[model samples]
Target: MSIPTLRMTEDLLVAILLGDSTIQKKSAKHELKFYLPPNKQKILKMYIEKYKLQSLICIEGVNVETDFFIVSNSLVLERIIREWSDGTSVIFLDPRLLKNSTYMLWLCLFGRKVNNQVIIKQNTLTLDTKHTLIYFFEKTMRTSFLRLNAEGHLKVQAIDELLLASIIDNRPSYESLALHELLTDHSKKSFLQKQEKMKEEMREYACF
Candidate 1:
């Protein structure tokens, strides 16, 4: 199947990828919902339906896990499943991480790739789809810590870019990282620093 023209604009796409939104914490219920700008949310709703991804969630709870190709678009699924029938799968991560920008920042600090398991990040999770560190960061942010304001608008657009840029600096390499990083490299220092911190956190997560 030929790839359809992705109608999502670059700016909106970035917001969606980053999960940009204002957050609200409800102590009583302990619930969260990431919101996009009104226009953007409408756009996303349409895309989700068009892509038939409304029910595509694979991983459950805080950590998500699922077959890669199942959630991918026809174009990507066809390409990835060709070589490996089983292909690779990814973890969606916990929603809480969205609120934990520090942790989110740390995860994207490195371009991580280990054998067949290509772990990067994106706003929406797709099977067999290699995720960019920035994309991954945005996913965690929206799923975990972000939401739309009462008026149904985004609160921090500029801040999102700054945060995204800072997170990019945290990632060292993208070539061996995710397919998305095949050619983009602007933030080497921050990426390296964030990488070290992540290693420590990984040890902690593993300890429990």
Candidate 2:
């Protein structure tokens, strides 16, 4: 069976690593393991299928009654482990990996909506990684970032949530569609306002 392109797989892997996944070495092969609640199993499976990944094995957690794990092994995964892992438990992500907005949208699956805003809790991320990711979001997505909370969780605040919704609408993947469901009604209102303003500007330009 053929696997997805390297770039696509790498983006998915990076998004997974940002969530509840880890990389471990067994003998000479590197394995990507994802630990999530049973409720999240469907999303995890959908993500794997969406990426057309191969050799991924899902296993029920032996100790945790409410959780399970998925294990995936591939040479591409090994390359990711070597490039992203710091030879320790901490994973150092390069900001360049944020190029794929679709995968970035998938990262929202790990986030929760609060007060009409989506907040991604990055408590486990290192300081450098957190800052870099914040920079990437602000520079590319027109979003805002809040200072780290008491728990060391960096909160990403979308000043205009519709910007994210627009990205999700364009992708039309399972992950994107799921994230779209989490968007607040305020985003729809904002999107409509932006559309009207754009139309007005276009009409004015045409008049000239």
Candidate 3:
């Protein structure tokens, strides 16, 4: 799969990072264009919504140029960093420079600082650590689900393993061969099933 080429200005990113710019709740209508691998998409959405990311955008993919504030976190932090690793020009904000809303998210999403530095996984430099956690967590969750389903103890219906694998493996960023090597059919199905059930439970118990 081909790496996505992001076309944007560095100065704007710097402005946002430096707290020199302001973001409104709504900006001019812009189409957000991002094509992540399939498996990564759900993970990305989870991070975005969990972080209330739209609060940080001055303009989001509307005109030829748009500004955004990205709140990097566990599942999608590595992906965001990977996008910036190719000299794509990412601006990192000093923790103090962030707005109240941004600061709240950083604290809630990333946790408190240890010593003076906060341990965050943003780019490829930290991808190994972040991906390792994601991989192991997903793998463990998948195993738990498969064990339950196999024992005829499913909370709902189950789908074919191959189909689930296809959903997780067919994203544009990761090559099919790579995905195939990374995730077995059974593992992918179990992972997807667990993810689906988790979402259903969250919605069922969501407040307001």
Candidate 4:
């Protein structure tokens, strides 16, 4: 079988690198590996089909193990690493390359909704990478919606969820859409009200 040409993109490369995917090199060849639980096989399949990477993909331990992995015989990931990563495996992605919102949407996959906010766990990222992401988000959304939580993860509160959903090209998952709607309808107003109330309380405290 002939090797397929991978339809690689900067956004997709960054997205995968932000996820559970890793790059490995052997005998002058570089490959990308994605490890997922059995339940997440559909994600791997979707990526393979989306990128026209079917011929280059190899699946391992799908049926016999609780976890499985997919390997893509491509050098694209290595090229990205060379450009983006420091020698210590910490990525310092160039802010100029983050022009597409699709990657931000992809990053949301690693997030979980909490009390009308989406908290994206990015503990693995270097501080530089985190700052770059924050800069990119603010520049693209034209708002200061993204911030780092106390745990150093990326967070977007309810007030900005609608803006985020609107900017991304791909449709969000049903759960995310539902949450966005609920937050947009209720949380935005209440969040503002709370902020005002807090200011009033501080004024009262100052007077006392």
Candidate with the greatest TM-score versus the true structure? 2
Choose 2 or 4, whichever is better by lDDT. Answer: 2
Residues 48-162, candidate 3, lDDT per residue (tens digit)? 4543443433333333233232322222233433343332323332322222233222222222122322222232223333333334323433421211122222111122332
In model 3, what lDDT does residue 138 have?
A: 35
lDDT by residue for model 1 (123-157), tens: 23333222332344455445322223343322221
**lDDT by candidate, in order shown:** 0.31, 0.57, 0.31, 0.54
Candidate achieving the largest lDDT: 2
Candidate that beats the other on lDDT, 3 or 4, i.e. the better one: 4
Error of 2 at 189 (Å): 5.2
Instruction: Provide the global lDDT of candidate 4 against the true structure.
Output: 0.54
Model 3 misplaced regions, further than 4 Å: 1-55, 62-123, 131-208
lDDT for residue 195 in candidate 4, whole number 0-100: 56
Clash count, one per candidate: 22, 0, 2, 0
Model 2 lDDT per residue over 51-102, tens place: 6654543333534764635445566656666787764344566666666453
Provide the lowest-lDDT 10-residue window in model 1. Answer: 63-72
Judge candidate 3 against the unseen true structure and give its global Cα lDDT, from 0 to 1: 0.31
**Where does candidate 3 have its weakest 10-residue lDDT segment?**
1-10
By TM-score, the better pick of 2 and 4 is 2
